[model samples]
Target: MSHHTVSVELENKPGALVRISQLFARRGYNIQSLAVGPTERPGISRLTLRVDCSEHTIEQIEKQMHKLVNVLRVVELLPDESVERELALITVGAPPDRRAELIALGDVFGARVADIGREALTFEIVGRPEELDAFEELVRPHGVRELARTGRIGLRRPGPRQSRAQAALT
Candidate 1:
């Protein structure tokens, strides 16, 4: 199975998310990550979902999503044409002797130290999934106290011709 990312635009209603999730659940499709937020358009929200499934399964999932009520649009984000990011907050055991080293490692990944306590330091890192994975691996030996991640969010980069066409339309 290949990994797929899909962005869905839908009405901002109470049960919209539930219905969409149910569709996936009923189909036995596992969602690896999901992030939802309001869009610039009023009463509309965007959901970015990452799933591991076969190409045929993903096609079916998209078609099923289109049939759901309140769903405005569904688009598959091609990796080559998209920019993806995820946010992770990780707290690690930091003794005085290792504190500086931990800070330096975080610095290399452009991570910010969000909090520091007597025995721990929390870092906020925002980057692609692979970068976050590497950061986690490097810090695991220091004893991770806690970790939280905002699942992947992505946007497709429009081609130059598409950009020009959009500008002309506007």
Candidate 2:
């Protein structure tokens, strides 16, 4: 029942997302959040996935994913490793009376007000999931009219850069 984040490298091609998502569905696993975008490498895209599953099930899924034609690699991100992660949150309709207080709380969590309107204010925060939870708890009583989040997007840290020689070999 633990939550896990996995990084999958795949070929940039049509129906790639559909194929991956369908694998999870067919296995009865729930994807908490998914982010897909191009990587530095040409013709390759990276998918950051947060899903809830057991280690055994995840291994099964990884093996299944490798069997697909487009899948290049699947690596589960471990917390102990050097990694970079970010998330953005938006809160609307913040009570005017608590504006200063909410703003201060956001400051404590390294968040900033992104937009302001007569009836609403949008705050954008980029950080780990735990940081987002703390920010949400601080602003909950201050009239959070709406909330939206982009779940963890990240990559390994301090890894050696691939030289042209190494890249060509791969």
Candidate 3:
């Protein structure tokens, strides 16, 4: 089995996420990571899903997804072609006598100290999955009390508009 990333553009409406998630669950495919957010268009949302499945299975899933009424478009985004993919991680911690050290370390990864409290400090970092992993590893000894992360989200760069001739061919 190999990992595949599929991006689905769907209408922004209630129960849409549920319906899409249920489609995957019923197929017994394990989703490694899923991220959904609003797109540039108003009333539209993009769903980025990373799943583990064989190539044949992925093709089958793609065909099946096309049958869904709410699904507007489904595109398989290749890593090299994708414009940007990012993950956000938020960590809260308090290292005794090591605040400056932690802050310095965070600075190296472009992480920001978002909040500070008597018992803990919250740091926010945005980067690729590997970067986030490295950041967490670096902060391990510094006393990371709690953490939350939004897994990878990606978008495909839009291509030039099709000419009238090309559109007619389709």
The root-mean-square deviation over C-alpha atoms between each candidate and the true structure, in angstroms, is 4.7, 6.5, 7.0
Q: Which stretches of candidate 3 lie over 4 Å from their true place?
A: 158-170
- Residue 158 miss distance in model 3 (angstroms): 5.0
lDDT of 3 at 125: 89
> TM-score for all predictions?
0.93, 0.87, 0.84
Show the colliding residue pairs in model 3.
Answer: none
lDDT score at residue 141, model 3, on the 0-100 scale: 78
The lDDT for every candidate, in the order shown, is 0.93, 0.79, 0.79
Please give the distance, in angstroms, between residue 109's alpha carbon in candidate 1 and its true position after superposition: 0.4
Model 1 alpha-carbon drift over 4 Å, by segment = 160-170
Estimate the overall C-alpha local distance difference test score of candidate 1. Answer: 0.93
Instruction: Give per-residue lDDT, candidate 1, residue 67.
Output: 96
What global local distance difference test value does model 2 have?
Answer: 0.79
Best by lDDT: 1
Q: Candidate 2 has what TM-score?
A: 0.87
